[model samples]
Target: MSCEETQEQVSLLIDAELEEPHQVALFRHLEGCCECRLFFDSMLRFSKAAKRDLEEIRLVADDILPLHGPLPVSVRAAGDGANSLPMHPSGLTGRRSHRRASEDAVGALPDRRSGWGWKRWTGLLAGGWRMPAPVAIGLALVLLVAGALVGTRISTIAGGGGPMGRDGRVVKPTVVVVCSLPEVQVLGSASRL
Candidate 1:
């Protein structure tokens, strides 16, 4: 492989995404090419630095675990189990570590579907997805009722109450009216009437 191709492959190699043959070819190129080797080292350092920035350590378990021994009544009750670590310290005044520890717990459980309890539903809802079935049904029913009421109001405004038939279209009268004096009207009206 050329030095340019090998340099391009460096990131894929670091991420473990290169196939075996390509990996061997790229390694061979890297062995001979000084510029490509330096580029690969720079990329590795950049990736490590980026990872460190993105994954800053919140409170370590050790920091809060030792503090667990001095349990106030609220904190003790909140712990639920002796083995359970207080992800948040319960006291109002004591430790500002509460926020950091809780943040750590949140960071630890990143998957939306898995580790959360009731909070998973809250996250799903907060993500702007639809509500549950029953709630959606209830909303639909409300919308349907609202639509029907508005339809009635509009029909009343548009001079409704014509004889609406089974299919809901208006039944028009078949008879035709002729315009004239009563005696003159009889001339045309008699046959039609």
Candidate 2:
């Protein structure tokens, strides 16, 4: 291959990615081209220096390096930073601890021990302490309305034109009119009054 192409493939060749035949051809090209040789030497020197620099840098226990391997989940749990342990959106803790707090806030639900059965609670209640207060009050109000209607009907009948008997009881007009019908007589000529 050309000198430019040989230099371009040199880094890949050092990493052992190219086939054996291609590697031999590129190596022969590199030997003859001084410019390609200088470029390859500079790349090797830079890689060695980068490796040495990385090895010399000290990494803290909680520091998360971009290129390094991931820390274990348990190891993160023991560290101080968020990288060490799973944290909540609030930056305090995870969902498990939050769920526990909410559970504690709302107490446990009433169960069978409270004697509130599904069937009894769902049915229509007639009369009892367990009955809804609104329903009982509504029934009493209906009874009161009915009594008022009956009393009004009775008072209307008493106030209408009625006959008074000797005992001071008011008799119905229909009964008095029917009783006086037989007592009336038609006379042809009577003395002038």
Best by TM-score: 1
Tens digit of per-residue lDDT, candidate 2, span 32-131? 8899999889999998998767644422211333212356766444343322334544434432343443442364223423355643543333333344
Clashing pairs in 2: 76-84
TM-score of each: 0.33, 0.32
Query: Which residue runs does candidate 1 get wrong by more than 4 Å?
Result: 57-193
Q: In candidate 2, what residue range of length 10 has the lowest lDDT sum?
A: 174-183
